[model samples]
Target: MLAAIRSIIFIPVFYGGSTPIIILAFLVALFSESGTHFMGRLWSRYHYLCARLILGIRVKIEGEIRNEPLLYVFKHESMFETIDLLRIFKKPVVIAKKELLVIPLWGWIAKRHGLLGIDRDGGGAAMRQIIKQARKAVAQGRPIIIFAEGSRAHHGQRPELQTGFAGIYKLMELPLVPVALDSGLVAPRDTFVQKSGVITYAVQDEIEPGLGRDDIRDRVHAAINALND
Candidate 1:
């Protein structure tokens, strides 16, 4: 019952409260991309507050966030991390599927903020385009965030990574950081009730560049699921 009440309050505030900020973001995008990013980060923080204060959920970090420009491969467990990571990083350029960039207002703002949209099924040519965009983003000192599984998985289920990860890693030639989190147990995918507990982000050590694709993949897959183990 308490969760239900909080959900009622959170639903309106989460989506409705951002109406004005989103509009401002749209206008600000015409002038500066940084303005939209600032607004987006503010919104992410607001959501975090709602999760803590309203839903009785807290976030606890267990590892250090690196300062170097590297590729961040995260475990996709819930929608919570999507917004949460935005606030966690400084100007992160997320590599999202092409379909997401076709959304109305949100997609427009994402494009303006320099997010990379890749055609997941477009074969080698698509991978090349993704590498180019990622390189550009890295050149500008923005960390690139990608989902190893390419989509959210069940709380305890670890799926194989999408083919693009290896391609991107090989082409970009940057250090990779595997981030693991237990978000599905709290704000689960395709659900409304958010349980009261601390969601933890366990940042594994950075995998240095120059490793073979199979070696890197094996280590990242293991490191990211370490928390689950």
Candidate 2:
């Protein structure tokens, strides 16, 4: 009953105010990202707060966030992980699908804040773009985060990872930081009832980028599976 009411009020308020709120926030983040690279950090923190306050989601960190630029590979369970990581990490360069850039204020903000959007279906073109953007972000000293599975996992299943990450790994040559999360399907797909629970994030040791493509993928997958054990 409480969750339902929260959804009722939050849904209308979110839809009604999303455009203006995102626009204002985008502008603020633009200046912040440009001036100090702290806007994304600030926006993420407040964004998480709003998610919790408006929808009743809770998050808990279980390990220390690494302090260097590396490829952050994590389980893709839900949108919550995306937002939550942004809030926790400092200037994390995210790799997302290009379609997200088509959204109004949100897309603009993502592009301006240095988020890398890939054309997942672009074949070689997409790989090239990812490598380009990723190298630039790494050069700027920001960790590159990739949802190794490529897309969100279903209620009881995990998605197969695309080989694109392998290409990025080989090209850029950076260490890999394996991250895992316990629960993110609390709200489920296409639903608004945020089941209240604690989300756990575990950051593992960094894997050097010199491993073979298959080896790298296997190692990252092992880390994620280890979290489930």
TM-score of 2: 0.86
Candidate 2's displacement at residue 95, Å, is 0.9
lDDT of candidate 2 over 1-229, digit per residue (tens)? 8777776766666556555556676768656766334555555666566667887777777677864678888887777787666677777788888888898778878877777888878999778877887788878888888887887774456555677878877887888878877665565556666666667777777788789988988888877644466
lDDT of 1 at 126: 87
Model 1, backbone clash pairs (residues 3+ apart or across chains), number: 0
Model 1 regions lying over 4 Å from their true place: none
lDDT of 1 at 84: 85
Using all chains and alpha carbons, the TM-scores for the candidates as numbered come to 0.96, 0.86
lDDT of candidate 1 over 160-201, digit per residue (tens): 888778878888889899999999988888878777888999
Evaluate all candidate structures by whole-model CA lDDT and list the values in order.
0.85, 0.73
Candidate 2, position 91, lDDT: 76
